[model samples]
Structures are given as structure tokens and as C-alpha cells.
Target: MTAAQMTSTSAGDGAEVAAKGTTEKRRLEGSLGVPSIVFMVIAAAAPITVIGGNSPIAIGNGPGSGAPLGFLIAGLVMILFSVGFVTMTPYVKEAGAFFSYVATASGARMGVGTAFTALVTYYGIQIGCYGYVGWAIGDLVTAFGGPDIPWPVYSFAAIAAVAVIGYHNIDVSSKFLAVALVCEIGIVCILDVAVFINGGPEGISWHSFDVSHVTDSGFGIAILYALTGFIGFESTAVYRDEAKNPSRTIPLATYAAVLIIGVFYTISTWALVTGAGASKARSVALETVSGNANMMIDMAGQYAGVVVRDIMQVLLVTSIFACVLSFHNIISRYQFTLANKGVLPAALGVAHPKHDAPSRSSILTTVLGALLLLILVVAGLDPLGGVFGYCAAIATCGMMILMLVSSVSVFVFFRRHHEIVGNPVTTTIVPLLASLGLAACLVFILVNFTMVTGGSMAVSVILALIPFLAFAGGFVTAAASPRMRGRFMANVL
Candidate 1:
């Protein structure tokens, strides 16, 4: 069979394909288990970055002390989404995550559309991280009395670093990410424990979860921002090609990623609220956020002393690096999957002969990200507000849409394939609920997009439309080109 025709059937088939003497068609190397997979997925979430970088805005502009409830709500929605998502993984034969699952249940046209959408989602987040990491490095340098360098210079440096790591086998990135994830989670936990021990000025309280606060006017925006922290969690399935015992690993990693991210965010946000006194949480958040500082970091400085605070400042930069590396791996694999299916250049489909990694695709992803960064520089946009803010808004919105579509696809796929024998609660009921929740998130994001992007109504509208445009572009390409149609129409499932 031709390389394009040999869709990925098993995560353990790498050696089989190699032994068959198909030197021209090496598959991605596999050996990753649950712990490794969990590390990568959680790193993509960048827990420290989310709490330190994103929590201020969420607290000030969202539900204030009630932000923890938003995390809880978003986590529950994701758990429901994962119920159907992981349940369908055993039947999918490819590592295209959203692309494979949607295609198997829906049609080639929609599958191709989803592939395009997934690309937009991952690339958006990756590029945004480049912007944030650039800003982060610049801040760290100045804090240490280093010369002032342009943020773009830092961004390029980070892109180069990620490119080097990503060109290696998945195992290398996984190990590095595991260490970074530990440090990121560690600092936050230290602060949490400190705040709990002190009991704050108001003496520890659950005021953040009060029904009145959760039902506040800003709760919708709180949920929107909270949901963004979970952006990369669903990516557990994207690494399936490199996973050992993927059917079990993917599900375990997915649940662990969701639960850890949810509980961590909830507790940390609550700690901040308690540390500041629930009544003063919003005011404290506004003071920090408005002055371009992180509320969590400030809280850490006050509760855990300058030592832990300094460590957090450094880890914040590393956290963004971890985010970039994790997303880089994901996008490269997606490109490899698309290439194997004939949607992209066939050259991108091949794994590295020595590393067994998607070297060609990784190079392309790096180039694309650099080009986007260059555009932001030439356009003279702010690394934090312009590049990070707008790009992150786009990524978060696009991911919500993908999750919604994936949820519906799960229900439809299971309903039609009675032979699969999935539990009704997980397959039908949970997915339907997940679809509604995600749809609400997408709508809320669109309606209040200016809040997320910190851009004008006009720019927010334009940025919001890009995901749909990408999906349409792919669907049209599949429908118009006879060659692409034939490739995309393959019944891999």
C-alpha cells in the first residue's frame, strides 16, 4: 500500500512498519504512558502562568472572589465533555484528535474543516504564548538589571529554543515539560499553604462560593476566562500516535489533566480571595491588574515572602516556554496527520529517520509562528496587550467551538454505531450536556469578546470570525479538489 493509504491503525505499529522495510514511511515513535502524557497536557495548560498571568483580569473583571466557582463550573463542563471524548477514542484509528473523531462520525468535509479549525486553535495559542513569553523574558531581564531588549528579540529567541527541542523525539520534550510542570505547580502550592496557615485578615472563608457571588452579573465573563485555562487539556488525544497503550493512557491523561487543572485553579483562586479578604478581593485584584502586576504574585509576596515571590517571577517565564513546547508538539503531529491523509505536502507526513519525530512539520510550525511574530513586530503591536491578548482570545474562542463540535460528534457517532456498546449516560446524555455548556461558552465569548481581547468591538468581531473562515476554507478545498476529496474521504475508522 502507498504511504498515504496506510492510516495509523495502532500506536504500537511503529516497529511493525519499520520491520516491513518501509524505510520511506517511518511512523512517529511510541513509548509514552499515562504519567508522561499527563505531564505534557498539563504543561500545555501552564498552571502557574494561568494563575499568575490570567487570574488578575479574571478576578478584577469577572466575578471577583467568586472566580473559583467559575473554575469549578468550567471543570465540570470539561469532565462531561471528556466523558464522550475518551469513550470514542478506542475506535478512532488516527492521531488527528478532533479531525479523526469528527470525520469518523460526521463526514470527510466536516473532518477536514475540523482539521483546519484545530490548526487555527493550536497555532493561535502557540503564537500567543510566544508573545507572552517574550514579554516575560524582557521583564525578568530588566528585573535583574539587564539591558532592555525588544520583546520581539526575546520572542524569536524563545521560538528558536522551542524549535530545537521540538525537532527531537517526543520523549525529550516530555521530560523537560515534566520538570517545568512540577516547579510551576510547586510555587503556587507553597503560596496556597501559606495563605491557608495564616487564615488571612478575614480568617479563611468560603465567601467566594456564595450563591450571591456566583450569580453575580460578571459570572459569565468569569466562566469564559476560567474555561481558557483548560484550553490544552483536551489535547491528550493529540499525542495518541506516541502513546503506549493509548486507549487507556489517553483517557487517564484526559481525566487527570481536567481534574488537576480544575482543582488547582479553584483552590489557588480561593486562596487569593481568602488572603485578601473576600470583600476586598476585587479591589486588590484591580490594583494589581491595573498596575500590570499579577495578583497571585503579589499575594505570594505578602504571604510567602520575597523568596517564593522571586521564584514565581522566574517560573512564570519558564511556564510560558513549557506552553509553547507542548503546543508545538501538538501542532507538528497534527501537520503530520494531515500530511499522511494527503491534505498537506506529503513531505510533512514522514517521521525523522533517527529521532522518529516530525522534524519537517516542526520546522514548518516554527516558521509560521516566527512569521506571525514578525508581523506583530512590523505592525508595532504590544507584546502583552496586542499579540498575547488578541491571539489568546482567538485561540480560546476557537477551542470552545472545537469542543462543542467534538461533543456533538461524540453523541452522533455513538448513537449510529450501536456495535460500540458505550454507556448511554456517557455517550449520549453527557455529550449533549457538554455540547450545551461549550456552546454557551462560545456564545458568551463572542458576545463579550472585547473583554477578552481588550480590543475594540470591530477588531474583536474580525478576530472571532477567523476560526469559522479557516473551517470554511478547508471544507471548500475538500469539496473543490478531486485529489483532496479522495484523500479526505478515506474511511479510516
Candidate 2:
């Protein structure tokens, strides 16, 4: 061969190699079992936070003892939602969760839209959680005679801790969450059992599940609170690539986490009511100057005694840490996914050579977290009200919208790829049913958006508009990018 011809051939081979490298499949450490996934889900739910923060408001404002019924109702709805969600997981494989499923059915544009919605929703919620963590950790430190640092300072510290763990092996975060989960769950259970054994002034009765309270003025509010507690449950699918058995583990873990969160909240909150008396639960909750904020801590003293109460306080901080870590990992994975798909910077998708974790994305997440928390600190926003409350409200509403979209996508996906699935109910009928129920949920949440955010009508409208705008922005990006548009169109099953 001529020397010039040889040079051209060598260049052509190098280009093919580069192209193959670009398309290489990356895998995360798959040391996770069902238990690890469950811990991750429950940690994100932040059980102690809900029972302590939202439960009092639920019982005091809603139907008193009947508030536990809200959890049961929400759980049933989630189970129905899961019937379709889990059923479709086998056909697609990725940590993309709703974005992957949405794209599978609707098109790439909708997929990107879901991705943006999830990024906004999870990041918003994660930042909101750091607000609570800051206050809790700072208070705990001061109680122990530590320095009087600002809450946001403690928040930055917590973000730093998350960054440290998030950059390492996934198991490191998982094992820590498991330990945290056990401590928090154990303390809560002690309170639950003690309350059950001792009964209450009104008796440990079925009054909590009573049907008449269905028409109570705060019924919508109670359901809204119940739904918020399950915000991170769908994230079971996000750990698919890291699961020991994605098909079985993901589905079972999703179902178990939802039911466990629902039942756990239902019983714990009911115990609070029974410990205080049904008719008096609402009045007693409001009688406090703090109004339901420290109700659980107080109950731990009353039912489980002071030693347990102190332990509970300590565990509450750990619970918050576990949650922060869980979300840190989640958002990092999300960044990895978006980068892998060319939606974000490609460097965000690279795993650590030593840890096989999304180190780069995790680092980016940690930096973003620090920057966002700084904004809240500079703006002088209240950690509890402004950061935690408002962001959680908007994120919850956003998640519901994603769930509704996913439910419809399930049905559409099955219809389009009829050959891939067999059971009609699992694929189509149940998905359609879930879609209807989730639509109702979204409507109800929006109608009560002001109540959820504890803000004026204008503020509530803006909170409601955020998810829609984020989703639309993603759609426009996808439509405008011919490369992405073609990729989505060509990748259809």
C-alpha cells in the first residue's frame, strides 16, 4: 500500500475506536440488595421528620383520630400506582426511573421533560431537607454545649459530610443509612408499643379509621400530608442498575417501602392521638405554643420515658443525615444519567476509577448544594418555613405530576409494544386506573397548594407553576436539539 493510503486507513481505524469508546456502557457497583434499596427509600421519606413535623398538623387540623386513615388511603393509592410502575420496570433498565419510562412511551421530548421535572423536584427537596438538618444539628450541638454556629453553617457541614460519603462506594452510604434507619425506626417503634399497651383516655380505638371524618374540612390537608411522606418511594427504580436482582428486588422493594412507610406513619400518628385522647388530640396539639412541632419528642418522654426521649433526639439527627445522604446519591445518579445521554456535561457521567461511584456528579451535587444553601443563608430565609416548607410543597406536587405521567406512559408503552408484555391488567388496565387516581391526587394537591405551602395565593400559584415550567423547558430543549431529537426517535423499542 502507498504511504499516504496507509495514513488514511490508520486515521479511519482511530475514528472507529473513538466512536466505540463514546458508546461504552458504564456500570455502578451492584452490591445492593432489597434491604439496601428499602433503606434508601425510607431514608428519603424521612419518617421521623414527617411524624414530628407534619403529623401534629394532620391530627390537630384534620379529623383527629381519623388522620391515620389518610395514610391507609394514600398507601392503597400508591400500591395501585405501583402495580403499573413495577410492572413496566422490566422492559427498561436504567436509573432514569420516570424519565426512562416516560421516554419509552411518549417520545424523547416528554422523556427530557420528565428528566428536568425530576432534577428540579429532587434537588429542591434535597435543599429543603438540608434546611431542617441544619437547624436540627445546630440545636443538638448547642444542647451539648457546642458552639453557637448558624443553622446554615451546620447545613454546609452536613453537605460536606454528604459529599465525603457520596464520593465513595455506594455501599458506604447504604450501610450508614441502614444503621440510621434502624435507630430511628427502633425509637419510633418503642413509642408505638408503649402507647398501644397503655391505651389512651378515649381508649386505643377504631376512631382513627372512622368514615365520618371523610367529610372533615381538613380531609384534603391530611391526605396531602400523607402523600408528602411517600415522596421518595418511586425512587426504588432509580437504584435498578445497582440491584442484586433488578426485576425482583426493585418491584418488591418499591411495594414494601410504600406499605411500610404508610403503615408506620399510620400507627405512630395514631399512637400520638391515642396517647392524648381522640377528642383532645386536635385541641392538645394546638394548645402548645409550638403547635405539633415537638409533639413526638414530648410523646417519647411520656410513653417511652426520658432516656428514650434523649435517644430519639439523637436519632432524629441521624435520620436527617441518612435522608441527606440518600438524596445526595440520588441526585448524583440523576446527573450521571443526564450526562450519559448528553443532556448535561459528559464529565458528570464518569464513575470513580477506585470506587465505581459517580464521583464527579456527586462532587457537582455537593457543590450545587453548598451554593444553594448559601443563597438561602444570604437571603435570610427561615430554614423551616421558607426553605423546607415551600420547597417540599412544590416538590411533592411535582412528583405527583411525574407519577401521573408515568402511569399514562405505562399504558401507552404496553399498547405500543404489545409483544413485550402479557398480562393486560399489569400493563394497561392497572396503569390506566393508576393514571385516573393520580390525576385526582394532582388536582387535589394544587387546589390545596396554599395550605401545603402555608403562603399567600400568589406564592402558591408560583409554587404550582414551577414543575410545569421546568417540564416545558426540557421539552423545548429536546425539540430544538436535532441530535437529541433523532436519538430519542431512533432508540424506540
Candidate 3:
């Protein structure tokens, strides 16, 4: 080739590389420090919502006394998994959390598969919250002697609000989440103290943690309930690319999220059991099974007074809103990553020049969630019982399986790249241990999904297998198309 022609080609290649490098670099604001990242992940966990919604079942339905142990075990497994997860962070600067990690360890085909699963799961969970949040808003109004609007109306309104929040700089959402998170935890602590002062129904006892109680009738289900509380904790890694000082920020945020949420679950659940009285916990929980979702509200009135109960009820709604918003942001970021990497339509990868957020991806996520909400409304399903219970369970189940895959993949990645150096615990053993814990949880969820959903076995089976199908489908699609595999390898793998 002529020198002039070669010179032009070289210039084009350099500019292309520079533009590629600048894509993620200039799109996200690096302002989300550790504390902000923590709020996002913890909010997604929705501590107040979990305690109010799941604790009664955990205490009464599952291993009665042994339920708290499930949190400890789940937390430990996550902490162990994080050791290897963050260890690999330095190698993958802007790659999507599980998307990149799974790709790097497995292959581009599998990575695309994992990305699809993560995307579907995050999207489903947010939609599930939308169903519940509308019902929550309706209740909030009627309880205050205000008019009760239809839930679908409230659901659409909430989707708009969340889309707006998610379309801005992430720091904006972080600050908002921090406030909601503090209120959620604060009220729980207040009620916890009051329960202690009032001495509970039968007074405090160690019966909540008794091994015999955990191994009782519904042992598998109790552990399932407790472990699901940590569903959003792994989202810490989701913000790695956008986090300030990502290497330091991610590990700290992840460890902190798991530890804080873990302690909160263990202590608050025990207090709840005591508040209801250990011996009477099962009976009280069963009584509430008909209605009265928030036993904390009941406990708040019993110990603190009526005023606290009302406030707690209001915060419960906000707690779920915060959770919905948090997941909205997560889904957008993941979709943006997929799009930019060629795993999805490129339109989703567009970032707002001014806001530095994935504007298009956020809007798409909002629209998709709204569409799901519409389907629920049109089907005339019960918002809380049918939509939230069924969709959320499937989402949570998908995430658990992904975590299981990630734990095992961490070991594979480190083992394959022997040149990659890290402590043995972080590189090898911890990943293996995490894999086992997550696998056990996945097994229980799959086997007992029908029982968990309180629905038809066929529907439960379909929901439970969504993650596996997404993962396998991604791999097969990629394997079938050389072009797709080439792009995944070039961009992400």
C-alpha cells in the first residue's frame, strides 16, 4: 500500500480506539463513593420491607428458632464470594458485574447468557415491586381518610417517578436512597427497643435460635425465606464501573452491605420473634396470615404507641419505593452495559451527555416495567398476592442461581489464569465455599418453589427455571452465531 493510504488507515484506527475507550469513561459520573453505593444495594434489599413482610413467615413457618442462622450463613457466603469478585475487579474496569465476571470465567457465549438472565431477573423484580407499591400507595391514602385511587394508576405514577430518578446522575438517586434507608432502619430500631422494654408477649427467650426449632417441620422453607432477604446484596458489584475509586469502593460497599443487612436481619428477626412471644410466635404469625402484613406495626403500637405504628406503616411504603427505584437504576446500568458490548440493541447503550446516566436504557427499563404493570392490571390479578408474590419470587430465584454460577465461575477464572495473583482464600477456596452455599440455596428454591409461591406447581416450575433457560439460551445463541461470539469476545470477554 502507498504510504499516504497506510497513514490514513492508521489514523482511523487510533481514533476508533480512543472513542471506544471514552464510551464508558465519559458516560458515568465517578461521584458514587462507598457510602452512596451502600445505600443503593441496601435499599434494594429493603430491610424494613423484608422484616415486615418475611420475618413472620421465617419465624413461624420455617425452622422456628433456627431461622436467624440462615442469615448468618447467607452473609458469610456472600462475603466469601466478594473476596474473589473484587479480586478480579482490577482486571475488568468497566465490564458489567456478573455479565463480565461470568464471561471472563466461562466464555463470551456464556457471558451473554448470564447477561440475559441478570437483565430479565432485575427487570422482573422491579415490576414486582411496582405491583406492591401501587397497593401500598392506595393503603397510605385511605388510612389517612383520603380517597383511595386505583392501584394501576398509582403504579403508573410510580413508574414515572422512578424513571425520572433513574435518568439523572446516579448521585441524585444515591442521596435519595440514603434518606429512605435511614428512615426504614431507624423505625425498626425504635420498635426493637420498645419491644424489649415492654418485655414482649412471653418475654425474651433463646428459643428463636434453637437448632431443634430450625430442624422442625418447615426447615427448608424458613432458610429459603431468610436467604432471600439478601437478594439484592450482590448488587454492590453492579455499580463498580461508576463507583469512585472502584477497586476500594466496591469491596468496601459489598462487604458493608452484606454485613449491615446480615446483622439487621439476624437481630431484628429475633426481636420480632420475641415481640410476638417465642412460644406464641407460630400462632400469632398464623393469625396474621389472613391479613395484617406488618407485625412491626402491631409491635410498634404495643410498645411505642399508636403514633409510631402509623409512622412505621408510612415508611413501609417508602421502603418499597426506595427498593423499586434502586432496582430501576440497576437494570438500566446492566442493560447499558449489554448494549455497549453488543449483547443487546445499541440504542440502550446511549448515555446522556449532560447527566452521565444511561438515559435511553433507563427509559427502556421504565417502559418495559410499565408494560409489565399494564399486563398485570389487564389480567385483573391481585397486585400484592399474584403479581408481587409470583414475579418477585422468580426474580429472587434467578438471582440466587446467578450468584451460584458466579461463585463457581470465580474459582474457574482464577484457576485458569494462574498468572493472576491473589491470596489463596480470595482466589480459590472462598469461591468454592460460596458456590456450595449458593448451590444449596438454589436447590431448595427449585425443589420447594411451589410451596414458596403458594400457587400451582406448573406455574412455579416455569418461574423457577427462567434463569437456567436464559443462561443456556444466551450461550446457545452466541454459539450459533460467530458474529455474536466475536462481538462478545471483542467487547466483554
- Predicted structure with the largest lDDT when compared to the true one: 1
Better of 1 and 3 by TM-score: 1
Instruction: List the candidates' TM-scores in order.
Output: 0.95, 0.93, 0.93
* lDDT score at residue 100, model 1, on the 0-100 scale: 84
Higher-ranked by TM-score: 1 or 2: 1
Tens digits of per-residue lDDT, candidate 2, 25-52, equal 3446586889999999999998987888
lDDT tens digits by residue: candidate 1, 1-493: 3222233454333444467688755467589999999999999999998887667677888888888888789889989998999888877767778888888788788888999999998999999899999999999999989999988999999999999999999999999999999999999999999999999999886867777876787888778878899887877888887888887889999999899999998898888889988878889888877776568878889999999998999999999999999999999999998887779997898899889899999999999999988998899889888999889988988898788888999999877777665579988999999999999888888888898888999999999999999999888888878777666655455
Model 3 over residues 80-118: C-alpha lDDT tens digits?
A: 777777776665555378877888678888788888888
What is residue 148's positional error in candidate 3, in angstroms? 2.6
In terms of TM-score, how similar is model 2 to the real structure? 0.93
State the lDDT at 468 in candidate 3. 81
How does residue 119 of candidate 3 score in lDDT? 81
Report lDDT per candidate. 0.86, 0.82, 0.78
lDDT (0-100) at residue 370 of candidate 3?
90
Best by TM-score: 1
Residue pairs with colliding backbones in model 2 are 65-208
